[model samples]
Target: MTRDNDTERRRPDVRTSLDQWLDSRRGVLRKGIAASTAFTLGASAATGAASAQQDAPFGAVEFQNQTSDGTTVVVDSAILERGGFVTIHDGRLFEGQVTGSVIGVSDYVEPGGADHLTIDLFDVPGAQFDQSQLQNTQPLVAMPH
Candidate 1:
């Protein structure tokens, strides 16, 4: 994972920039803070800046560590400046970096915010990687793309 320290927050025109932003921060779940909180807020703020002038692309996701049925995940909130999707990963924090693989993904969301969003797990058919159901004991990350 990489940290985006750039003070100038410009709207990215490609998915790679969003990927970089999502990978920018990785931290252990601390008391009162979710692991993906920083990135979520950062992404919101970055896109918020651009939105101030126009309808700029933005994305943010925030959720608490919670129990799951191993078949789905419910995100507390997700905001996409444009149409996009959210992904759930079997993420773990190692040396302040996240490492894991995507395990689930939500269907295409319309441009706006969603709460209590439930995403079905491992529904991709003929996937090349492991498609096992999510585990309750597994650390997870909810990322918007």
Candidate 2:
């Protein structure tokens, strides 16, 4: 094949592959931005900084410590600046953080908030420790993600 023809053939293939890769990366970037925004806003809300700006990114989760059947958790409320989900984790505070496996997750919550939210529990796949160790008997931490 002529050098020009070979170059033309390779150009489209490379361009198409690059375009596909970029598209996938854009998706990942969008998701990462959303998550970071949520986490940042959630931190602000926790410190009472984002209470007035309802349109701004913010998240808050509130629930009382209680017992459960290891199958579900009740959150008094969950506030989110955008569409997202809330997760339940063991309330094992170590080094100022909840060092525990996910116990439950709520379905997609729309922008705004939900009252008396109920999250279904399940052993997260590939847990480092047995789920039962943190179930029923320990306090659970509800977080917005």
The candidate that achieves the highest TM-score relative to the unseen native structure: 1
For each candidate, give its TM-score against the true structure. 0.53, 0.51
Writing each residue's lDDT as its tens digit, candidate 1 over 17-131 gives 6566556543222311333334334456655644533433457778787887788889898887776777776653433443245566788888997888898777744544554
Worst 10 residues of 2 by lDDT: 91-100
Cα lDDT of all candidates, in order?
0.62, 0.64
Per-residue alpha-carbon lDDT of candidate 2 for residues 1-145, written as tens digits (9 for 90 to 100) = 9999998877767767777765784544444344435544665666554452444556667778777666777899878877687777654422234434466768888999999998877645555445443333666566676
| Each model's total of backbone clashes | 0, 0
Q: Report clash pairs, candidate 1.
A: none
Kindly report the root-mean-square deviation of model 1 from the true structure over all alpha carbons: 13.0
